[model samples]
Target: MQGTSYYIPAAAMAAALAFKVPSLVRAWRDPLLRAVCALLAMAGLVFFFAAPPTIAKVNRLTGVTNFSAPLVYALLSGFSASCLVLLVNWRGGPAERTRRISRRWIAGYGVHIVLLVVLFALGDTPVERLRDLDTYYANTPYIREMIVLYLTGVTVAGMTMNFLCWRWALQVHGWLRTGLLIIMLGYTFNTAYGAAKFAAVFARWAGKDWDALSTDLAPILASLGAQISAVGFCLPLVCQRLADTWHIWASYRQLGPLWRELDKIAPAHVRAVGNLWWSSAELSLTRRESDIHDGLLSLHPYFDHDVHARALAAAVAAGTDPEQAQAMADAAMVVSAVRARVADPEGKLLKSSDTAESATAEGTRDLVRISAVLREAPVAAAASGHAAMPESEVH
Candidate 1:
């Protein structure tokens, strides 16, 4: 179970780093992205080194028994520092204050790193007990202090992160807030991991054996916390991208009625850009909007002011809100114009009006609303009937 836990987070952090590499390369100057990449790298290192097989290999290679102990501690200290810096960069306050806070965290963690190295050097452990190092050296002088110091530093960092995430979660909204709350939960587990380890060490000092807390239980907590934290950090970015894609696809589908009507009247205006079946929603929507504008421009001569006025009155009589009624009226005018253009392509050109200008405007919210009205409004059917009549037959 411990092995599985370690490998899972290690794989996840590696995948996250791989996913962000392209963005990091494209925006190398983006401090927040750079911080995120660094955090993932450090987290990956922590999990990679925490595995017992890796620890034994490192101890064997370094010719110092249990060298992986200090190495893992140092990597974990660096990971904590990276998390703090990433948070600072992400929150984004005054530039000078951010730099100062980041510098202080780095310096403080640097001291922890130095302390870990010095204590590891001072301790004497001939046996390479990769998994049971803490229990083995529970009573040893320098080794005991070394374990306690690392635990203290980890606990402090975890507590600070939990507080920061919880406080910030209250101020944000949407996926960001949800992500922060998840991060806080992860950090809560991290703090528990530290507390468990500390309890084991304190038990040793009090002449009791609670070794399982450090040797077995704490590691599980660490692994669970690390994996959850990685997912939490990634959640907002992934969710936001999904949301944007959904909005684009929704807009494309909503604009279908308006796009199809205009295309029938002015098929020549449609520009073939790519395979319609394979095109992305954003690209398809952009092309559809461009084609709609061109088609509307071609039908400007068929725009009837009286048709628009009557549609507005009808929409109002139906108890639609003023803003929505306006959109319905605009949609009615567009449908009527398309029918008139098809009925008589050589009809006299109507002079440019505000309605024409607004109808043809690129990527406006009003256009989307009007497109929706065209899909379901009764005013559109009435306007189509008026447009279907010949000029001599209409009053």
Candidate 2:
């Protein structure tokens, strides 16, 4: 059961690392991405080797009674260093400063790892204790020092992360703030995990037995902390990508009415060929916008200024804001022009109109509003009906 708990989180971290691999390959120079990948990989390794089954397997494979002890400690130290390095890059600053700070953390943990190995080698531990190594060797010669050093390193890192994330969360908003808060919570769990382990080890030194803190309670806390921290790191990034995709697709869908109308009048050469199956939503929207502009250019000669003026006045009278009034006016003129073009199939009404050109020059939000007005505004529908009347009708 304990092995299953460790393995499950280890597998989850492996999955996350797999997802990040392609992006890291594409942007290998991205320090933040590199740090994220390293942190995830180190986290998985910590859980994998720390599992009792794996620890027993490694000890047997190496023909050493307790080799897994220093090994897991070194991995945890590396994991702690990884967390600090990731934090440095995630916060971001001047390039040189980030690199310098990251190097210092790596070097510091590198020394701790060497000391753990040296201490473990000097200590004499004939007995193998997979689940409660810290407590089992609490009073041993150099193994005791090894236990204190690794736990202290983890505790310091956890507390430092909690402080930094808490302070940063205060100044941020949206998903970023939410992610930071989650990270803080994760580190709080991690800090507590370190405290639990320390308590169990110190209890053994004081002629008491509290091995449950290390064997039973601490592992549960560490696993939960790691999994929660992984979510905290990934949530904002994944949510940001999803949010951007939603916005792009929403814009593309909103422009549909205008794009369809433009497609009807735009020449084959000017119109987008077909649905670009391979194009991204952003590119598809860009092409649709281009096609609408071309259609407006083709319809320029048939645009009626009088229709636009009357529609603008009616929209303002109806309490539409100035921006929306302009869009309504533009939509009325466009619908009127389409009707006028249909009525005069001979193309004899062709003449340049600065009014139409200016409407065509209007930006995307205006185009979106014009598209909405086409769908919902009575003024635009009325203009289309009026333009369809005979050229000699009471003029």
Candidate 3:
């Protein structure tokens, strides 16, 4: 149960890294992207190495008693540094200042990791304590110092992250603020993990046994915090891409009516832009709009000014808004034009005096409105019925 807690978050962090690597490679110079990938990688390593099964495996593979101790400590220090550096990049400032601050944190944590390894080498711990290593080695020589260093580093980083995110969250709005609030909550759990471990170690120093706090409680807290923090880091970036894809797909769907209406009159020579199966939503939407416009141009020769004038006056008299009235008028003209072109098939409509001066719909939005009225408006339906009457019967 305890080991499962660590492994779950480890797997989640690995998945987050997989999702981000392509973006990192594409924008190699983006400091913020680099920081995010670094944080995710370091976080995964910390969780994987901190698991008890992994700790025992490392000890066996290296043939050194408790060798996993210094390794896990160094990984924790690295992860702590990564979290702080990522926060620094996320809250941007002047380029030089940001870089300088990031470098300082990296160097400081680099030295701290080295000292942890050196102190572990100097100490003697023949007993392999996987879960309760902090409490177990609390009184050991240099091992004690190594444990203190890692715990302090993680605590300070968690507190600092919570402080920055809370302050920034209060000033921002929308998705960014939501992400920050989640991040702050995650780090609060992390800070509590550090406190739990420290309490267990202190109890050991006072001749008492509270090993469950360090062994059982701390891992649970750390796992929850790490997983929540990963979500907070990813939410804003993922949400934006999702919103863009949704908008593009909706625009494409909304244009379907107009595109189909235009498809009936499209000239065989126009060679419509084809959207391949694997094409992106944005590309497909653009192609559909282009095809609609082409069809509108081909239908222009059949437009009747008399049909447009009557539809426009009737729509206005019916209290339609100006924009919608214009759209209805254009749609009625299209309906009459399509029928005339079908009836005359030999270009007779092009030679008529009733052909409109300006007949084609102009913009994508206007085309959409015209397409909508074709299916719903009474004026367009009336025009369709009137155009179906024979020319000799009208006289």
Best by lDDT: 2
TM-score of each: 0.87, 0.87, 0.79
- True lDDT of residue 326, candidate 2: 85
Q: Native-vs-model 3 lDDT?
A: 0.82
lDDT digits (tens) for residues 156-235 of candidate 1: 99999988888898899999998888888888889999998888888888999998998889988988788788778889
The residue pairs in collision within model 1 are 301-350
Q: What are the per-residue Cα lDDT tens digits for candidate 2 across 162-189?
A: 9889888888899988998998889888
Residue 72 lDDT in candidate 3: 90
**Which 10 residues in a row give candidate 3 its minimum summed lDDT?**
386-395
**In angstroms, how far off is 330's CA in candidate 3?**
4.1
Whole-model Cα lDDT per candidate? Answer: 0.81, 0.84, 0.82
TM-score, model 1 to reference = 0.87
> Runs in model 1 with CA error above 4 Å?
1-5, 268-275, 317-319, 344-365, 386-395
Query: Pairing residues by index, what is the TM-score of model 2?
Result: 0.87
